[model samples]
Target: MASITLKTPSLSYDIHIAAGLLRTLYPRLKKLYPAKKSFRPIIVTSENIWALWSKDVLASFPEPPTVLFHPVGEKHKRLAAVEKLADQMVEAGADRDTLLLALGGGVVGDLTGFLAAIYMRGIPYVQLPTTLLAQVDSSLGGKTGVNLATGKNLIGSFHHPLAVFADTNVLATLPPEELRAGLHESIKAGIIYDPKLFKYMQANAEAILAADPAALTKVVAASVKVKAEVVGLDEKENGLRMILNFGHTLGHAIEAATQYKQLLHGEAVAWGSIAAVQLAVSRDALSEEDANKIVNTIMTYGPLPQFRADAKRLVTLTAGDKKRRSGRRAFVLPKAIGTVEVVYDVTDAELLSAANSMLTLMKAQA
Candidate 1:
């Protein structure tokens, strides 16, 4: 098992990564939440995940939890879903003492965490992220929110989890595309902080793609460590933490333009990373050779699902990104394989150029 600790001004927690960690969840929760308090467990999950893993999760508890199920997909992540979840919790007589167990992927984690954040002003929650994307990125960040029709993650709060249980065993059941989607964030981590980790992915692409336990464990732990360090330094994305959004600026825009239906978060990120690299090279911040390496690394795991949205629309959507300030938006562009800088000097024309170049590359590959 690999463990990483995240410390923030608001809260601190440990993320445990191991196969079969789910079985240990009840005991861990008991230690964290104790028997002294009259807290009730509410397992928030998707219908698909509930069917597959609810039995294992329920077996860990002394009593049956208040299991709430939502239909799966990015399209389902909205204020309406949050409202419905809150209504369900209200009917169950939930209060600040209610413990939310976010038990699926990013959507489940995000929605559940948000529900806990606003429920009775704030409640405790644990993240039981089941997907690769959630395990590597969203599950640990304390970033919880649902999307609005205007943009991705526009309505959310920073409510840290009490603990995060990232069970590697659940990853075996992931569809190949979903697994690849998760890899994009790990790739982002490597590009922004750890060169060795980036090389590990490059050298063991085959094993990683095969879902080899050792390789996956190493990658997950390394990625988590990078994020933990960054989050520790700047909890609210004030300065140092913005680098973690390397591919997310345009990535979020791409997701919004596509209406969250056409592309997975990781897939949008993969393409967005490519666009960021292109913009970096155009500005002489990164070498063309290094840009090619980054692009090829992403391509190794993708021939991402095809989707079409206008470049103008993508550029327009960037206005809604959380990173925007005053009249400019921050773009985390690579200076090299293991270094990135957040800059606001980028122009709309430059963004349009990159978006066009990315669309062209996607069409060519398709």
Candidate 2:
């Protein structure tokens, strides 16, 4: 078991990573919320996830929880979904004492967290992230929100969970594509903050891809540590936290271009990371040798799915990205494999050029 503590402006929470942790969830909740505190535990999950793991989860509890289903998809992540979930809780007589257990992937965690943030003017919740992506990235940071048609995560809040229980065992049921998609965020963590993590992933690519228990656990722990450190410093993405968006600037644009239907979030970010590296090379911020290494590593994760979108259109979509501050776009570009810089002065021409490069490479590989 790997235990990490993340301390933010409001409070600190523990992220527990291990296999078979889901079987012991009831005890963990008991430790967090004693019997003296009568709180209704409600689980927010999707039908697919519930079908696979609900038995073990329910067995952990003394009684069955009020389970609410939220459909899985980037397109379904919206204010309306949160409102509907909130309505369900209202019908169930939920109040400030309701404890929301987010028990699925990123969409479920984000929706449940956002629901907790606004329900009764903010309640408490814990993340039971079942996907590799959620376990490593989305589940750790306090970022919870749904996407707007304009961009991803446009409407959200900084509501931290009481704790995060990431059972690596749950990943055994993930589809190959989903597993591959999630590894991109781990790569993003390595690119932005942890050089050791980068080399580890490079060396253990085979084992990681195979979903070896040891390799996946290490990746989750290392990636969570990187995010915990960053969020600890900048809880609200004020300064240092912006570096976490290394590949997300254009990545979100890619998602919007396809209308969130074609590519997964991690796949889009993988291409966006390539584009950022292209921009870095053009700006002379990174050497060709290092650039080749970064791009190759991204591809090493495998044949990222291809998407069709005009470079100009992708660039145009970025203007609506929530990362913009004071109406100026912000971008996180890499200076090296393990170092990145956040810049606000990136021009549309530069972005269009990078997007073109990314699209060209994506097509060539296809």
Candidate 3:
């Protein structure tokens, strides 16, 4: 097992990475937190996981803590749903001292962490992420957010969790598409911070897709460590964190164009990444080879799923991207594998051309 601590302005938390962690949750949490006369927990999960792993997790609690289950997916991540969860906590008599157990993937982690952040100004929470995406990226960072109708993650706050419980075994049950989608974020982390990881994936693409145990742990652990270091430095995203949105600015637009239902976040990001790479080269910020390397990485991670999306409408959606500024459609484009540039001055014509060019490349490859 490996451990990392995230120190942020509003919160501090430990990330525990290991296999078979679901069974150890009780004993370990009990040690980390000895049962006092007053301590209690409130478990928050998505409807998907509650049906799958609720028995083992709930049974482990001394007196099964209350769990508020939200219907799963990015669509449900909204203010109304969060308010409902907070109301449930208050109705259950939860206090600031009570711990929050977030027992699902990134959606639940983001929603729950945000709930914990706003509830009574904040409360401690644990992250038991079952999805690889959450295990590798979202579960470690204090960045919590919900989508607004106008933009993806247009509303959010930075609130770290008390602990992260990543159980790799749980991923074995994930749908193959979901598993492939997670690789997009993993690939983004590599592109932003660890060029060596990009090389490693190049060599182990087959094994990674197969989900070999050793590869899973190493990739997940390394990805988490990289994100942990970044968030530890800038929790509020006031400076360096925007680079984490590498493909996300345009990706969010792609998501919104599709109503966030057609493509997984990763899939949208994959295509969005395709556009980001082209923009970099078109602006001469990077060599053509660099763009090709990125495209290859996304392909190696997983071939982008086919979807019929309108190009012009997607470009319009970028105007509302949080990263956009001065009313320009912008993005974080890579200079190389491990570094990126956040350029919000990208022209609308450039964005549409890039989006169209990417669709051309995708079609050619398909």
Candidate 1, residues 203-276, lDDT tens digits: the string is 89999999999999999999999999999999988999999898888888888888888889999999999999
Candidate 3 residues lying further than 4 Å off, grouped into runs, are 9-11, 31-37, 325-330
Cα RMSDs of all predictions? Answer: 1.0, 0.9, 2.0
TM-score of 1: 0.98
Candidates' C-alpha lDDT: 0.91, 0.91, 0.82
- TM-score-wise, the better of 1 and 3 is 1
Return whichever of 2 and 3 wins on lDDT. Answer: 2
Q: Which whole-number lDDT from 0 to 100 does residue 87 have in model 1?
A: 95
- Give lDDT tens digits, candidate 3, residues 1-366: 878777776666788887777866776676656557355788888777888887767556666778788888889999999999888888999997788888888888888888888889988778898888889888878778898989887788877776888888888888888888888888898888988887787788888889888887888887887888888777777667777888887788888977778888888888888898888888898888877887887887766776677778888887788765556555788999889877757788888888998788878877
Candidate 2 C-alpha lDDT tens digits along 114-161: 999989989999999999999999987788999888889989998999
Clashing pairs in 2: none
Q: What is the descending TM-score order?
A: 2, 1, 3
The global Cα lDDT (0 to 1) of model 3 is 0.82
